[model samples]
Target: MVKSADGVIVSGVKDVDDFFEHERTFLLEYHNRVKDASAKSDRMTRSHKSAADDYNRIGSSLYALGTQDSTDICKFFLKVSELFDKTRKIEARVSADEDLKLSDLLKYYLRESQAAKVRLGCEELMMGILVCILKQCRAVWLGSQRLVDWGRRNEDLLYRRSRSLVDYENANKALDKARAKNKDVLQAETSQQLCCQKFEKISESAKQELIDFKTRRVAAFRKNLVELAELELKHAKTGFLCVAPAILELTQ
Candidate 1:
């Protein structure tokens, strides 16, 4: 039995026990991948935050430098240009780190796709087992119905004894037996119906879980993309600052 988010217990069918085990294994692997991705995301977030803070600090320092006299401004500009060059190299390293991260993210996405395929295969196997079981149950029910019909039709022959009292007794006994058999068949059919209902509910829950997993993966991807874009913008701004003094000198 597996417990769902709602605390409902989903009983696994014996026929699909192997499939369920395979699914459990896959889930374990998927969980590990999620943990790795989460760790990487956290590192990336911290790195980006540190880089942003450093850029802000440098910008504040540059603003203060701008308040000095012309000679001091020239000396500051020279130093600022050297600092900007160093910053440009740092930006390159950051870009490289982002590229590596993107690569890892893509690999993780591929793994997710493979995992989804495995999950789909498992579902298909479970569905096949369900269909086979339903078919077998239906066959049994149909066969039981035919037996009941045959017994009813042969009631007279079954009681074809010489004495009237004996014949009446035999007919009553046969009727009782037929009624018991019908009751058994009805109970079996009811059990099968219940089992089918449970199976369907479990299948739906699995589908919903898959959807939720994909939603989370997509959200993470979007977040990473946004961060990468922001990093690129920051790099471009730094480049502009590095070239601004040269532009101003040429203009003069």
Candidate 2:
């Protein structure tokens, strides 16, 4: 058993390029999922805001009806309107909290998964820096490309070496050509070796970076979700508390 650079004990890698390519693909897919989630969250935020506005409009209509006339029914309308008003405010508060804690969190990550060359909005900048899985995936991709180059060079060297060997065997005049091919093969070998070394170094760092990326992402999501849940609960309780007395009076 051989230990990988990420400190995971495993069997030897038969194909280093395949390993990193798989990782890069997974990260890209994961980023796409995050983008989808961010879009959904934005929709949810808009829905929440719309609901709050609807509550406010309903409350205003009820209030207008109550004030247009004087009767027990009108008083009841006023009381109901108060309940609706409280609901509107509470809903607005909940919407804001969700936007701040949940929707923004997803948006921030979505932006972070991008190349980071593009400038973010002032709001996203305030959220945090944009360096994580995507950045490391880029590194992994470069490393995989280097491995591909090395493989291509090695294949070229093999083909040339075979051709030169055949030519030298067929004609003594081809000796110089074979020597020239050998020199090219030696240079290609050196370049391929360098590529392999750089790829190995990148792969090692990428493995560790990916591990850290996962850890940080999980923690951040957990923290944001926990806070959002707490805020929602608080708003729910406050809304209930504000409407309870009006409900009791209406029932009586």
The C-alpha TM-scores of every prediction are: 0.40, 0.62
Error of 2 at 252 (Å): 2.1
Candidate 2 residues lying further than 4 Å off, grouped into runs, are 1-15, 114-180, 184-189
For model 2, give the 10-residue run with minimal summed lDDT.
117-126
* lDDT by candidate, in order shown: 0.48, 0.58
RMSD of each: 20.6, 14.1
Top candidate, metric lDDT: 2
Q: How many times do residue backbones clash in model 1?
A: 0
| Candidate 1, superposed: residue stretches over 4 Å from native | 1-20, 72-75, 78-185, 197-252
Residue-wise C-alpha lDDT for candidate 2, range 108-171, written one tens digit per residue:
5665454221111001112223322232246544643443343333323322322333333333
lDDT of 1 by residue, 1-252 (tens): 121211111122122435435655665676667667657765774675577557556755664575465676656665664564456465655645574445445545544444443333322111110011121246544643443343332222211111222223344455566567765555555555555555555555554555555566677579767877787777777777766765676456
Best by TM-score: 2
